[model samples]
Each structure stands twice: as structure tokens, then as C-alpha cells.
Target: MKKRSGAGLRARVGAIFVILAATVAVVDGCNGQNSIVGGACVTGYVACADQCVNTAVDPANCGSCDVVCPSGVACLDGLCGGPVDGSSDGSALGDGSSGDGSAGDGSFGDGGDGGCEPPFNRSSACGACDVVCVAPNSACLADPSGNFVCAPPCTPPLVECENACVDTQTDPLNCGVCGKFCPSNLCANGVCQGATPGDVVVLGHDYSSGAAGSSQAKVLTNAVFIPPSNPLRVLSYEQFADAAAVARVKSLVQSAAFGRTVVFTPSTTSADLASPTLAQSYDVVLVYDQQGGAPANLTTIGASWVTSLSDFAKAGGVIVALDGAAGQGGMPQLLTSAGLLAVGGHQTIPAGTPVAVVAPADRIGAVVASPYGVYNRSVSLQAVEPEGPNVIYVAKQLVNGTPANPVVVHKIVNP
Candidate 1:
């Protein structure tokens, strides 16, 4: 009797399991429609990018995802044409894969600092008020297309070098880093020293993709001064800072090899910055003008670029940095990685902010024109002070007569 009862209970449990399975299938919708409770959009809204915004009314997300409206417009219906047009018609059209995710332009006040702003709203200067438009005609225009000038439009043979058109075959004022005059020696191949065709490899915008603002267009056209014998190769990118870094590297070469064999390459990405074989290939790696303000590729940094750059430095590869592009704002991470930026060493000041001279007899003082105007292009000013024993006060400027207010400094990477 006991055995019979156990068998009956097992049969009953199996029957219950089958019924539950059927109910679950019905709940999930077998006919292609989802099970809706309390309406699909009104209360049970699907999660979109960046915020908990209602895509039906959010301007950033008019109908589809990332389909943002202009600054003064609002999202209506399944489209965003002008100002507010029509209603949503009580429908939820999502990208289908819905849930809380990272910030996208799904709408305003959704999350992650109000998601995305309109393209024309560079008034906030990148929409975050981080960038300040100092130039008069440069009103933060959102370069609508890619077809823009990448190189200086100088007629071939008559190259435009340093704001003036000159023939590379014979030009001394703009030879190498410009003003490297030699009254006695003949100018050969733009070099005041040797005219022989040396290995001149340039990682620059001249050979880069003609993308608007990818690499600094000036850096490439200036290559004319590098001489005709050296091979010019560009390692460039589409972002401004990344491209500027490439220019910075080139400048480093210019500083060292002003009249020597000018071989240079710039890093357009973190991968380029941290190339494993970079130290082997290049004699000196210049790091400056890294990322700039109002950059597009902020979070897309490579993990090993800093390490790679540091390894190159430690391996005796020379690194020359002019501005804080590689020292502070642009590639502050590199400074930190190379042990240059310390707890109280990094200093920052506003652009054009006047500071008293502390070390006018130093190297920095020898180069700069005035105490003010340290950083003119960037809205925020940043710099790293000298650190470690080898850290030297090339030049120091003070804001309020204090030792901590150093404006110009140089820190050794390894020592």
C-alpha cells in the first residue's frame, strides 16, 4: 500500500511540472508578441542608453536609438523633425535589446551627465563647459564632413614652410627647426650641417588619411624643411590630441636633430604610443601635445601605451617634451607612469594668467617670452613640477610668491 501511494505522488508531481512548463511558454508569448502588464510604455518602460528617459518624448532619442534632435527641438512621434511636432501615439519602439546600460543619447537627464547634447550646442564647448573658445573665428564648428584640407595647400616644389612659401632645395631661415642659420656652411637638403640624404622617417599627417583635424595639418607640410632625401612616413590618427602627440614626437626630434638626420614618428593612438618595438626602431620618442581639450576619444585609451612609453625611456630612448601635453592634461598619465608627477609636484594655472618669475635664470626662462601666456590654447592650465634628485628647476614662476607655485619645471623620468 505504501509503495502504491509513493508512485501516485510521483505521477502527480510530474503532471504539475508539465502544467507549469506550459504556463511559462504562454507567459513568454509563443506568437512573437511579449507579455505586457500595465501597458508596454506608460509604466513598464524599456531601459535605454545613459538614462531612464522616456524615448517617446526625449529629444536625444526621437524614435530610434542615437537619433538625436537639435538643441532647441524635442522628440515627437517616432521622429524628430523640428520643434515639438506630434505625440508618441502611445507606442514603445526600442532597439529590442532593452535594459539598463551605459550612457547613450537615449534622452536628456537620463544619466551620465545628461547623456548627449545637440551638435550645435558646442556653446558649452563640448557640451560640458570644459573647452573655452579663445580664437575669434573658431566657434567650435562641428566639422559636418570629412572632406577638409589635411596638408598645407602649397604648390609642389615651392613648399610652404613655417608660414612662408620656400623651396626646400635651398632655404635656410626655415631649415630644420627654423632660424638655424649658418653663414659659413652651405645649406644642403634643408639641413645646415649635412646635405646627404639621411634616413628621414616621419610619422605625421603628410602621409596620414586626409581626415579633417586628424593630425595637425601644419606638422605634415612643415616636413618640407626635413629635406627631400629623408623618407617621410606618417603615423597619424583622426583625433586632435592624438595627432598633436604625433607632432609632439616630431618636435622632440626637431629639438635634438635640428640639423642632423631627422627621423621621426608620431603616435596617433595608445597602441601607437606604446608600440613594443618603438624603442628599437626610433632613437628618440617625443611625447607632448598628447590629447587636447574637447577630445572625441576620451575613454578609448590603450592600457599599455603608458607602460610602453616608460619602458622606452628606461631603455635609454630619449624623450623630449616641450609643453604639458605629455606632462599634464594631454598625457598626464604618462608623467605619472614615468614617476614625474608626484603627490605635490603637479601644478596647474589658467592660460594667460600672469605669474611672477621665480627662476628667470633657468632653461625655461631662457626659452619663454613672458611669465604669462604659459598655455594659450587650453582653457585649463596644467603642468608638472621637478621631482626626484635629478628633477631640476629649469624655470619657475610664482602666482603669489610661494615655493609651491612653480610654473616651469623639468623632472627626470628614471633618475
Candidate 2:
């Protein structure tokens, strides 16, 4: 082979360098990081009709070459869409933001971040984004001010009470009006069962009052006064460690007078007491003393249980606690913890003490005659003390002819 000249060698090397540069350009362009060969198009640009174009924001070539966007729409992230910034021109792709624009401010329209697009008037996003309306009954409606809002769940002849749709004219829990519960669970044409609407009614004692024929037993039986037509569904807790106390409660509730109007269900457990669903299924919750006259078990009476009980009482459900059930770690403690009772404790009254009607003319006092005595010789009575302002002392025990220690009390937790 003939030896190459220096000028020819330099020309060959320069050609090789040009070829290598073109190869690098092709590789870089394929990787979407630089311009392609012949400098036809840069990164994020596509060759169209011998010209480079950015399809992402080009209205004339939206998403692809020659794909023109419609009028009043903007090419946004390879898609044609209307403006989300309340502009009629459709100049802005989103609300002037590149990420989720909701910001939890209950706004609507596209956020441009590929997140969920809230429906205009859906129940899950009523009136505004994330503003959920009450389910199963409510709907989104325009208010008088021309603004979208959640309409009440109730229709004509019914009203919304505590997020529930009910007929005030017939609902015992909302007799005549919302949050007006009838103690007897009876409502007739918006009227409560008893003669007085706000009268206090007391029932039951701390312990057993001897046989059913005893005067104390008769007094308690008469005080219940629930109508037979509108029977009460009672949920009784089985967590009472004392079998004797449980038996006594069963006897009292199962008596001929009480059994007729009271349907007792003794299937509640410690876990069940914490469930609001189970609590709402009954009209009354009965919690009596535990083993050795101790208060209710702290493990059973937790924060959730107390909250369920308080909510039950506020929703027209009655809570009947007996003996040490109202003592420390029991209903009193629960009430105090829930801020329903300022002070909570119990007083032990000697056996055979006389009970006097303190609030005569009240529904509870009207049921029993004054100067009554407990017939049970072995069992003593427990009187809950320092009642909240909402509580009404119906009867008190007379120790040595002096009235003291509340034996029977009544309260209607409206709040």
C-alpha cells in the first residue's frame, strides 16, 4: 500500500470525528436528553413537516403533529382542556399550579396533577370538593343565595335531627320537636306519653326490695309506668361479676308488672357496651353492682364505653345504674369523665331506712306513697350524691327521721 500524505490523513480523521459526533447526537436524542442528528429536533420536541414542535403546550399540534386544539380549550400536558382558573379564555391549563390544587379548600375543577376530579353535585362532594353531604337521604341543592348546599335529609312532615330524618309528630325520641325525647317512649300526635312533658320519672332501687308483694317492690313497679302498647327494649350488661346481683336484677325486671312492658335482652358484653350501634338498638341500659359490692370493672368501663353510654343517654336512651354501679369506676365516674356530672360518688344508707318522696307532684313521686321502707333486711341501699344540675332528686332515705341520701333520682340528658 502507498503511504498516505499528512493532508489526506488529517481530512480522514476530521471525517471520522464528524461521524462520531453524529453517532453521539443520535444516542443522546434517543435518550431524550439532547438534539437529534442534523439538529432537527431538541429534547421534548418532535419533528413535524420538517419543523420541530412542542406538542405538550402547542394548540396547533396538541398531543401529536397536526392535532389542533378546539376553541376555548388549552393544550395541557398533551391533552386539550378548558381553563381551571375560572377564565373563559382557557389560557391557563390549571389553577396556575403544577400540582394538586385542591389544598383542602373545597374547590372544584381540574387540578392538573392527575388527581381525582370531584363531581359537581355528588353526595361525596356536595357543593364543593370534599364537602360530603349526609348519605341515604340528603341531596345537593341550590340555596336562596344561588349557592350550592346540602339539603336536609328529611322531607315534608319530617325533620332532620342529629343527622337523622325523623317525623317529629310520631317519633318518640323526637316528640313534637327535635331533641325532645319522651321518657315513656310513647308519642301521640307529637305529644309525650305522660301528663307533663318535662316531668321527672324515677324507677328501680339500689338493691332487691324483698318479695314482689312488698310495699317497696310495689312502689318501684308502679314508678316505671311505661305503657304496655309501647314496650321498652332494655339491653342489660352481663359483666356484673356478682351472680346474686345479676339474679336480683333479673327478678326485678322479669316481675309480672315490669315484664309486661319491658323486653329484657341480657346479651351485652364488655365489648358490646362500647359499640354505639348496639347501644342505639335498646331504649335502656342497666348496669348493676359487681362482685363484693365493688364498682363496675375499670377494664370494662373504658373511654369508648363511657362515650357510648353518654351518647345513648343523649339520644333518648335511659341508663339505670344500681348500688355500686353508681360508685367510683362506675356510672358516676363515667358521667364525670364525660363532663355530664361535676361531682360523682355514692352514700351507703343503713338497711330498713325510711324513704320519703322529696319532689312530690313529680312523675316519680306521684307513683309511690311517702314514708316507704326497704323490705330487704340483709341488703343496704346506695345513694348517688352530688348530682349534676341536670339530675332531679325524686326520693331520699330518712335516717333517724332526717331526710338524707338520695335513694331515687331522675335525669333526662338532652345535650
Model 2 residue 288 lDDT score: 55
Quantify all predictions' global Cα lDDT against the true fold. Answer: 0.37, 0.51
In terms of TM-score, which candidate is strongest? 2
Ten-residue stretch with the least lDDT total in model 1: 199-208
Steric clash pairs (candidate 1): 50-103, 51-110, 202-233, 203-235, 204-234
Residue 205 shift from truth in candidate 2, angstroms = 4.3
RMSD, every candidate, angstroms? 22.3, 21.3
Q: Largest lDDT belongs to which candidate?
A: 2
- For model 2, the local distance difference test gives 0.51
Model 2 off-target regions past 4 Å?
A: 1-205, 213-215, 218-229, 256-261, 278-280, 292-296, 299-302, 324-344, 375-389
What are the per-residue Cα lDDT tens digits for candidate 2 across 318-373? 56554433224244444344333333455444456688877776555565668777
Worst 10-residue lDDT window, candidate 2: 101-110
Q: Whole-model lDDT, candidate 1?
A: 0.37
Q: How well does candidate 2 score on lDDT at residue 322?
A: 49
Off by over 4 Å in 1: 1-258, 292-303, 321-330, 337-340, 343-351, 355-372, 378-386, 401-404
